[model samples]
Target: MSGIIGKKIGMTSIYGADGRNVACTVIEAGPCVVTQVKNEATDGYKAIQLSYDERKDKNTPKALKGHFAKAKTTPKKKVVEFRDFREEFEGQVKIGDKIMVGEVFKEAEFLDAIGTSKGKGFQGVVKRHGFAGVGEATHGQHNRLRAPGSIGACSFPSRVFKGIRMAGRTGGDRVKVINLQIMKIMPEKNLIVVSGSVPGAKNSYVILEK
Candidate 1:
């Protein structure tokens, strides 16, 4: 897959060809810099690494600063690698070459948006795992409404089994939303709008793969 790194820019609604108002996630996608081009002979795999978003030199790690320097580009806030990259460009892309949103979306009709989902801290079973709580509170069911009902059987292998869906942490995960339709592209603004929602909060980095 070949892709570009982008920043989520909230969402908006727009009319489609069918005269329907379609909800879309707006993303500021690229002018991503090609920071590294890995080959099997070197890194044991073939990949294209792209860097996006500006970052202060002082805030960037020393090693990453050197890495960006090797690419002849400024320090970037996010870096992502795409393996088995599609031949989307006219020719080989070298370090420091910019992959603009318009150029990347020219050959893509749909994209897989990969991003970190908004973190919902520790939550209960009802909210985290969608468990149906004990209803009505009738028949002395107080304080057990949202509680995880049981652990395990009394005497047979009597420990709580793994992955029973008991609640702990929620969200703040790497999520990929596949096959989002290309709703609109404002190349002049280097922005892309895709149908439906994308993972992560506003200003978060998202990788759009084709």
Candidate 2:
């Protein structure tokens, strides 16, 4: 799918034409630079690499500095590739081209927003996996309220099985919200207002695909 790199610029509510308040997420989408163009003949696949956001030259590594120099652009904070870009833009896009949000997306179009969810650090099974705790507060159930009952079969298998839902890490995973409606497009500000919520915290980067 073809898409653009964007940043979540928080969220807000807007009055719709039907006099209803709609919640939307504001995203600073694109003005992304085409950093590299991969072709089947050379890279064994077809994909277009895009770079978004700016990074100071001093903070960028030497190798990456050289890579950005090839595209005649400054160091970027985020770089991602999209395979099988839209057919209309296939032969038109080349290295150093800038793709803006307004050029790619339109209001009312359905899109998929991909981003990393907010991290909740280490968590227990009750909060992490939504496990219903040990029934009632009776039968002398002390700290067994949030415990994960039995882990495995005892005498038969003799060992704990793999893929058991347990408490560990929570959130901070790649999440994709599908069928999000593009409510509005602000071309001058390079912002796209999307209906409903998106993954990740405010100001985090997200990819919008169609």
Candidate 3:
């Protein structure tokens, strides 16, 4: 499906046509430049590589700088690839094609959002692994609260079972939520406000796919 790379510019509420306040995630979508185009014959697939957010030439890498040079555009901060584009969209989108959010997605009722989730660091089984911590709170349970309790049988396995639930790091992973409705599309400022909360913290890079 065709899509574009964008940034989560924060969130706000706007009134829908039904006169109800709808929570929306404001995103600074495209104005994304086509950095490369892949085909089955050449790259073994069909996709469009896009770049967003301009940066100083001195800060960009030599390979990326050359890639941008081929596209005839300045250096960009982020680059992403979209796969399986249609024939109509193929010729229209070439290297150096600047696809704004409005042009690519207009009146789009739904979208699929891909982003990195916020990190929560290391956590316990009660919070991280959802293990039912010691339930008793009044049976003389002084310090055993929020514990994983007995892990396994005494002598059957003689060792703690592998793949046992335990405390560990949480979040900071790639998450993709589908069917997010597009509330509004602003071409002038290259903004797309989507309904509901998207993954990741504010200002994080998000991919909005159709």
Alpha-carbon lDDT, every model = 0.90, 0.94, 0.89
Instruction: Please tell me which predicted candidate would have the highest lDDT against the true structure.
Output: 2
Q: Taking the tens digit of each residue's C-alpha lDDT, what string does model 1 give over 1-210?
A: 788999999999988889999999999999899999988889998899999999998898999999999999999989899897877552488999998888878533899999999999999999998888767688998888888787689888878788788889899999999999988888889999999999999999999998
Candidate 3 lDDT score relative to the true structure: 0.89
Sort by TM-score, top down from the best: 2, 1, 3
Winner on TM-score (2 vs 3): 2
> TM-score of the candidate numbered 2?
0.94
- Give the runs in model 3 whose Cα sits over 4 Å from its true position: none
- Residue 30 Cα positional deviation in candidate 1, in Å, after optimal superposition: 0.8
Task: State how far residue 131 of model 3 sits from its true place (Å).
Answer: 4.3
The segments of candidate 1 whose C-alpha lies over 4 angstroms from its true place after superposition are: 88-91
What RMSD, rounded to one decimal, does every model reach?
A: 1.6, 1.4, 1.7
By lDDT, the candidates rank as 2, 1, 3
Residues 41-88 of candidate 3 have per-residue lDDT tens digits of 999999999999889999989998898999999999989988986556
Please report how far candidate 3 places residue 128 from its true position, in Å: 1.9
Clashes of 2: 0
